[model samples]
Target: MQADVETPDYLRDAKAAGIGGDERWSIVDHVAANPRAGDLIVGSGGARKIRFAAPGRGKSGGYRVVTYYGEDDLPVFLLNVFKKGDRVNLSKAEINALREELSHLAREYRQGVMRYVKGR
Candidate 1:
């Protein structure tokens, strides 16, 4: 199935990482085609970390994308992106914040869906 991908923070992140044009779309396309392409981050409330290679950087030296796929019915959210060397791992506080953010996103999405269905 074709998955919907939401990029709330991706635009800024990608611009910061010097990724745009086809490179940006490629990342979104890859994630949409394989929602489970990344590894689940511990304590991230369902966020996954996926690697995308830069033009000549290759996967090992590319960017890290943090995404959340709460459920099959929900759109995948691209939370953040950064170069591999920019950050190795998130701190405890960062993980906690991420969990809370994901929780809120899921809650909001579900509520919106409910409202849409009821309206129809």
Candidate 2:
């Protein structure tokens, strides 16, 4: 039997309902602080930068991004699918800042990607 892999819309709705701004942000910060552990700087095509990446994840059609969620799977994917990796051996504030910045950068990156793709 093919187990359902697609994320349910109810889950999305539940998430939306369950997490307010600060709660969601705290969860994001916790994930980034703990599981993901670190971030890497990446330059976009427009010379803009992003946070969090493993080395060889740059290949193929994959994105080298820094998303807030995906704690359980991303490291595995980054390690197994890519090369070159590191975690922050820095202070909590620094890691928190990096995670927060990564969250912002991911938003900008997504907008930029949409614009780029739509323009082309």
Candidate 3:
């Protein structure tokens, strides 16, 4: 089954990082095809980090996408996107904050599903 794709507000700011429209589409398509693809970033609340090649650019000069796929039933959450080398690895404190925020996000998403089903 193809997982639903979702780009959060932060990810939508890809333009700021030189991620063009076509490149974004490619990233979305690739993630949808391979939902579990990417290296799991430990302590980031289940976020998977993937390297994506920009149009005409190899992976060395591509982008990084941080995503969260909470469950098979849920949509793939594009957490953040950035150009390579723009930032170093996240610190422990950053990961801790992200973990908490992601946990809250997942809870809200799941609750929304339940509410929808109950209403139906």
Candidate 4:
């Protein structure tokens, strides 16, 4: 697989490449709002949790992407399905980006989760 996979903003971010913040926020919130995103946060670094899904698709009915980012600074991204076949799969590149973005977001979330957890 390509190293570009799962590396966010490594090349061109969905927003910088023309995608908007509102669009990115839509999915992030939608995923967080949905149960399909699950309650399991992606990494151990953050106490705060934001969830997401990468469907490698566009406006599909079956695919829902769950992404994790900081509680405050959520990564800007949206799952765009470029093709459809017998199965659903996200690109390694996209996963990488989401991961990168999620890491940044998780930091903010972590702080909040920490504060909230500690009753600070």
Clashes of each: 0, 1, 0, 27
Task: Give lDDT tens digits, candidate 2, residues 41-75.
Answer: 33211111123222334323222222233333222
Per-prediction TM-score: 0.88, 0.28, 0.84, 0.30
lDDT of 1 by residue, 4-120 (tens): 655657778889889878888888898888887788899988889998887887988899999888888888788889999898677889889999988899789889889999999
Q: Of models 2 and 4, which has the larger lDDT?
A: 4
What residue runs in model 1 are displaced by over 4 Å at the alpha carbon?
A: 116-120
Instruction: Please tell me which predicted candidate would have the highest lDDT against the true structure.
Output: 1
The lDDT, on a scale of 0 to 1, for candidate 1 is 0.84
Q: Judge candidate 1 at residue 106 and give its lDDT.
A: 78
lDDT: worst 10-residue window of model 1: 1-10
lDDT per residue as tens, model 3, 1-120: 456556565556586887767767778888888778889889988988888876677787778787888887788888777777676356688688879988887779889889999998
- Model 3 has an lDDT value of 0.77
Put the candidates in TM-score order, highest first.
Answer: 1, 3, 4, 2
How do the candidates rank by lDDT, highest first?
Answer: 1, 3, 4, 2
Candidate 4 residues lying further than 4 Å off, grouped into runs, are 1-61, 69-87, 108-120
TM-score of 1: 0.88
lDDT per prediction?
Answer: 0.84, 0.34, 0.77, 0.39
